[model samples]
Target: MIEVRNLTKRYGPLTVVDDLSFTVQAGQVTGFLGPNGAGKTTTMRMIVGLAAPDRGSVTVSGRRYADIAVPLSEVGALLDAGAVHGGRTAYDHLWALAASNGLPRRRVGEVLARTGMASVAAKRAGGFSLGMRQRLGIAAALLGDPRVLIFDEPVNGLDPEGIRWVRELMRSLAAEGRAVLVSSHLMSEMAQTADHLVVIGRGRLIADTSMSEFMRSAGEGTVHVRAADPGALALRLSAAGAGVREGLESSLVVSGMTAGDVGRIAAYHGLALSELTPQRASLEDAFMELTAGSVDYQGVTS
Candidate 1:
């Protein structure tokens, strides 16, 4: 497991991470989410000892990353896929990292094949595409088969197939009882990939919850109803304290009430209903609402 308790980081006058705390448990994928410049990368760096936190602590299995004798075997991370030497081959890059960590050289070929880079293992790092580079980075992270893994934007430039591949790979890693923390801007993908979420904005924690609970706490979902007497039903629902608004095709969007309540009200009035659907807020909707005020920059249009 990975534990970050009140983790804080600063640079001169600017604070990049502020009192952040979350746990990435084994056997699950915890998605680290935020807007641009939300300090996600900085937090990941702090976890791996790339940057020292000004305060608080981050530990793997109850030990600071620096304290772990064989750090790679305890925690693996892919912060920047392009941070490797451009002149080296994919195979050479992993070899160097393994050597530095005192890991076996045989793991090199295993990870190359595991990340589907076996065919291009000899290709120079500078010549690889972004997706291929991502694969190589992941291969390096898996070099030690660590129990904790951190991946920052692993699918940044991947195609649909590549994205699916990464999704499955992360799932499999979690299934193998490893703590997986992934950071991404893709809401749709995160919805399907992550079991838990740590959302932040403007260097502060916004929310830390499971996917289902987050959606449920986003307030009551609006109910869409298509009734035989649309006009009469709207008035009755409005009178019953439901916020009613016109919807497409002679339907009413009723808020501040549940679908069961709406259906019962329509039935009491003897109004036949064709559709009574509850529209829950999606992940993107909830994220936008939660982080609306914390965006660093906003484009304005007149």
Candidate 2:
């Protein structure tokens, strides 16, 4: 398991990650989510000892990363594809990292095949595309077969097929009882890939819960009812303490009332009900609501 307790980081006069505490358990993929510049990269770096936390601690098993004799075997990470040498072939790069960690050379072939980079194993990294470079980075991360793995936006520039490949790869890694933590700004993708989530804003954790639980907490369930006289329906629902809002042309969005309740109300009022459907907010909707105020960057039209 990967455990972080009150983890904090700072640079000069700025604090990026602050008093963050969370646990990434084995046998599942936990997504690390936040807005741009929310310190996700910094936190991942601290996890692998690439950058030191100014406060608190991050540990693999029960030991600090620095204290783990063979840190690679305990935790492996892919922070950025560009971290590798541009002039070196994928094979050569993996060989160097393995040599530095005293890992066997055969594992190089294993990870290359696992990440589907075997075809391009001999190609120089500088000549590879972004997706191929991501695969190469993942291959290097798997070189140690660590119990815990971290990937920062592993599918940033991939096509649908490549994204699916990465998703399946994460699942397979967790199936073997390894803890997996993947960071991404893509909510739709993360919803499909992660079983749990760690949502953060302004360098602080907003939520640390299972995907189902977080959705349940932030998601609202409403009933949509359409009637010939929505004004009458609205008045009745309002009198019944159900919040009602205009929806579409002749429909009312009713809150605090179930479909059955709406049906009963319509029958009691002798109203002609055309449609009544229940709507529950999705993960994507809930994420937008929760982080609406915390978003740091957005694409704007000039």
Candidate 3:
């Protein structure tokens, strides 16, 4: 598990990360979400010791990343897939990382195969496409078979198939009992991949919650109701304290009432119904509403 407590970072007059606290638990995928320039990358860097925090602390499995005797064996991070030596082959990159961590040479080949890059092991990284580079970066991160993994925008340039592969890989890693934290701009993918979310805005923690809870609280769901006497049903529903609006030809969209309550009222009024469905808000909707004010750069039309 990863623990970030009151982690803060500043550069001159600009504070990138504020007093943020959250945890990435084992056996689940935690999504780190924010608008661009929301200090997400800085926080990840601080977790891996790439950038020292101005205050507070971060730890992996009860020890600071720097204090771990074999950091790679404990925590693996893929912050930048393009931050590799462009001149070297994919195999060489993973090999260098393995050697530096005192891992066996055979482990490099294993990771390459695991990431489906064994066939391109000898290919120069400079010639590889963005998707290929991402594979290589993941291969290097898995070289030590670490129990904790962190990925930043792992599907940035991936095609549809590649994106699906990454989604499955994250699930597989967490199934193997590894703690995984991922940051991505793809809300659709995040909805499918992450069990929990850590949302931040303006360098401060906005929400730390399960995906279900986030959606539930972020939206006031509407009930879709259809009845033989539509106008009558609407009047009855509104009288029951539900806000009703006309929907389609003969349906009513109701808010501030539960499906059960709607049904009970219809039965009480002897109103024959054809449909009664509850529509919950989507994850993307919830995320946008939650971070609406947090976006630093808003593009406006003249």
Poorest 10 consecutive residues by lDDT, candidate 1: 280-289
> Per-residue lDDT tens digits of candidate 1, residues 1-302?
98999999999999999999989889999999999999999999999999999999999999999999988899999999998899999999999999999999999999999999999988899998999999999999999989999999999878999999999999999999999999998998898999999999978999999988988888877899999889999999999999999999989999999999999999999999999999987788889899998899889999
Off by over 4 Å in 1: 224-240, 244-254, 260-276
Question: By the TM-score metric, which is better: model 1 or model 2?
Answer: 1
lDDT of each: 0.93, 0.89, 0.93
CA deviation > 4 Å runs, candidate 2: 222-277, 298-302
Please report the TM-score between candidate 1 and the true structure: 0.86
| Model 2 agreement with the true structure over 1-302: per-residue lDDT tens digits | 98999999989888899999999999999999888888889998988888989999998888888898887788888899888799999999999999989999999999999988888889899998888888898998899999999999999778999999999999899999999999987787888889899988878999999999988896468899999888988898899889899988778999888889888988999988999999987677788788877787877999
**Candidate 3's error at 88, in angstroms?**
0.9
Q: What's the lDDT for residue 19 in model 2?
A: 98
